[model samples]
Target: MNSLYAMPGNEAFAELLSLHTGYQRRQLLLHHFPDSETLVRMAPPTPGGDAVIVCTLDRPDPKALPLMMAAATARELGAARVGLVAPYLAYMRQDKRFHPGEAISAKIFADWLGHTFDWLVTVDPHLHRYATLAEVYPNAAHVVHVASQLAVWIDAHVTMPLIVGPDQESAQWVTAVSNLLCAPSVVAHKERHGDRDVEILLPEMDKWRDHTPVLVDDIIASGETMVQTLRCLHARTSLPPVCVAVHGVFAEGALEGLLAEGAGLVVTSNSVITDTTQIDISKPVAEAMVSLCEANPTETARRTPA
Candidate 1:
């Protein structure tokens, strides 16, 4: 049996993963102390086959302790193998220390997960400086691309879609996705004044104003860029542009704010579980996990999710 364990926030995604791999759904009894210390309880046994932990690392601080406990406990409980499927991997943005005496969190987070789990599989992490996951993680690591899924979404929904990269960083993803959709793509120039304040300048759009602009990016953390870009799109076009992201790290009201800002569509992959987007990316995640487990089938405990 595949021992699949999931945090409370990840139960829905766990269900999807179980459906994909035909693994039994297991839940971890997660608790929080008054001082916010996390207390994790083993709700299911670590089966002999493979242990798969399905925890998308969004708002990850609180779940860190529980994940550590769960992984360690699974090892002690005789799991045949262990792996993690974190679709929306967090702490990947800060690869370097911009200021002195700051911790290189990306390296720390990578090492922590690398040490805890036998292997790691994620989808479209907010990778900035690092070229690949194997650079930081000593164990097996895999990344699932959702550009194909986003392309499928574009082909089914939008007509005459003009894919727009909100910033230069997003240009690569936008260009790749546009090629997948066989549509024209444009990259907007961005000037960041501060953490929350940003300015977006679009090039001449007289030829493509009628085309439905779809803003694409890897991650939408603060939603500042998307919101600002939405406002810019509203000023230029009569219809609101569709906003799509690989990881919907929509802080607080980012999704609602985008919709209220006259967004025609706001969708994200199943990498991050949210109410707005339901595009499934479980197939790739499952495949990555299966490959990871097959490679390292130690006498370990595997936690199947959901």
Candidate 2:
């Protein structure tokens, strides 16, 4: 497959991509845009007739401009199709509008991306109530890759662990991991008390007492939920060794707070790279990309050359 890399100011992550993809170092295009002028100045001079893989982490306002420009450049370079491997997809958590006049950011973002690329691949996207990425990006071939690597990582490190879901919505992920590890699983019912305060109702500790309880959740935004759950768990009985989360957004001291709450080790995937624990999910991400490429050969051909 013809591929081009667009760096997003993260050398370690780019190196990880190279290592996992076996793509040559030179093939990865590194861009350092300190400002909009720098970004527009360093835009790819010409598309290289290859699928551009944008690799970036989460930022308050991510540099999506570069990726969008790169997609346009690739199309101009004669690429039949373009695909995005954004480990941390933005605007996904807001798939729907809760208040009047509130825009469906997820759909709008997906539409914006669809206009630029033919397909998108992301890890553990915050689909919320959406069933699939296809539902979100109906016009584009979208692949929502799960963080199965989390289970593998947990298996390798956590023994006889109890999988704890931060909320009812996370039951699917928690159950899947529990079954895979042959461990018990419990879901915590959480109620938002205020902006950052939450109350958690954990399962009876009869079976979970003294066992390593690994809280599993898709996204840990402000970490209020996880922190509250951890506090409640500690109050009920002895806390577990660590907590395992899929997407460690860890927005605003979430990681530090979790660590402070006696969390042994907070494990997460490279989806949203964090300093704590980033178990690589590149293999699954690549697999999802390959599947999309295969399934949408016609679309791929239109955007990328054979």
Candidate 3:
């Protein structure tokens, strides 16, 4: 008898997840004050059931306090356990302190979330530095990979897709999607001139010139890499390339920018609610949420050593 709660802006995905998990969907009523305080109100949780909060932490700064308050409210309402289903987790880019006096926000954020939720679930958190979520999160945490889902979208939408990675950082997941789709792939080298400027050096892709290029990446924040990649592809083929990604963190006209650069189609997982989110990842996330709610975190911690 797990109860699902949807935070603000996450109701649609939460409802889908509830349908998959067969859990009753609830809502957390939030009242914001002018002084920047929040009051979270939710119905009492079932006596022996887990209270799961579905909040996608994409733009995490404003949502952090409310999420903490919602979890605490659930616990105060006599829930047996509390968990979070954040489809797109943020604050994972800074996994290490690159310079002196820098704050490793990744670990700090993970620790804060670990303290708040008994169990956690997310989709494809930026695991560049930390090998796994377990390294930073202290409780049972699950990562829902969206590579197969990405492949499904690309295979169904694109014709004769030639999977392309924007840069070396994206090679791993891009390769996974390419292999899953059994499409030829190429990785490009990227030189960052500035925050929104990048130079893409693609290998000789004349062999794949005939096939429709499908540029793939995990997070499309600034979208400079994809834009640069599209520019490079312009020389190879006249056909408009398709762009697919897991999270579409379209920062200020990023989507329009890609379309303006000659992307035939842009698609992403529903990890973030945007018009380009054609792929629904709620089922896998629901499965992980159910598993996390059922398993005992203490036993899981014992089995997996520090």
Candidate 4:
């Protein structure tokens, strides 16, 4: 009798999750005031039944407050347990303080979310420094790996794909997808100058001349890394390359820029709900939610960070 509630901008994904989990679906209504405050409301959740919130935290700053409010409202409305399903979790990149007097945003954000919800589910979080989500998120957190999903898409669409990781951070994902497809793979070397500036050096691809290159990564924000990789790739090979990522957080016309920079195609999971989101991740996400629901929230709360 759990009810899945979709926050604004996440209705379609929630509906899909509802179908997959056999959970009744509802919308968490939001009204924004002129001063930019969001008022959250929803139908009273079933007593003793779990209340699940479906949201993808891409541009997370604006959405975070409303999400916290919704969780609090759900508790007041009588739900026995409240959980969050954020497919593309944000604020995971800043796991440590890089400079003097800098706040470790990743830990701060994780702590905030941990205090808000009883349990959480997400797709591949950017774990550059942290080993896992549980390292930061205090409450019970489950990660739904989408390697099989990405591999299935590549196997179905691409022919003789040479899976390529744009940088060392992407090596894990690239290896997973390639192993699943039984395809050759390579990882590129990236030197980031700034947030908007990056340099890419692709490994010699003379051996993969006949194979189609498929660049895989976890998130595509500015798309500069992918664009630079495409430039390096086109200089060495004649075949047009394809780009695949889990979260398509395209900023400042990045998707159009990629296509214009000679990318043949760009695809991502439905985590961010872009036009390029062709892969469905609802099944795995739903399964994770169900698994979390089966566990006692009180036991999970015991694992909270000190």
C-alpha lDDT score of every prediction, in listed order = 0.81, 0.69, 0.88, 0.91
Candidate topping lDDT: 4
Tens-digit lDDT track of model 1 for 4-57: 788777888888778888788765787778987777777555556667888889
The better-scoring model by lDDT among 1 and 4 is 4
Candidate 2 lDDT score at position 127: 73
TM values, all candidates? 0.91, 0.86, 0.95, 0.97
Candidate 4, residue 42: lDDT: 95
Tens digits of per-residue lDDT for model 4, 202-259 = 8877888989999999999999999999988876767899999999999988998899
Candidate 1 residue-pair clash tally: 16
- Minimum summed lDDT over a 10-residue window in model 2 is located at 40-49
Model 1 regions more than 4 Å off:
32-38, 43-48, 296-306
lDDT by residue (1-306, candidate 3, tens digit) is 889999988999999997787899876899988998999999888877899999988888999889999998898888778889999999998888888999999999988887888888999988887888889887888999989999988888888889999999999888899899899999999998788989999998888778999999998888889999998888898689999999998999898999999999898888999889899999999999988888964554322221
Q: At residue 248, give the lDDT of candidate 4.
A: 97
Question: What's model 1's overall lDDT?
Answer: 0.81
Where does candidate 3 stray beyond 4 Å? Answer: 300-306
TM-score, cand. 2: 0.86
Provide the lowest-lDDT 10-residue window in model 3: 297-306
What tens digits encode model 2's per-residue C-alpha lDDT throughout 62-138?
56666676666666656566677777778886787877899998898877767777777777777777888878674
RMSD in angstroms, candidate 1? 3.6
Q: Arrange candidates by TM-score, descending.
A: 4, 3, 1, 2
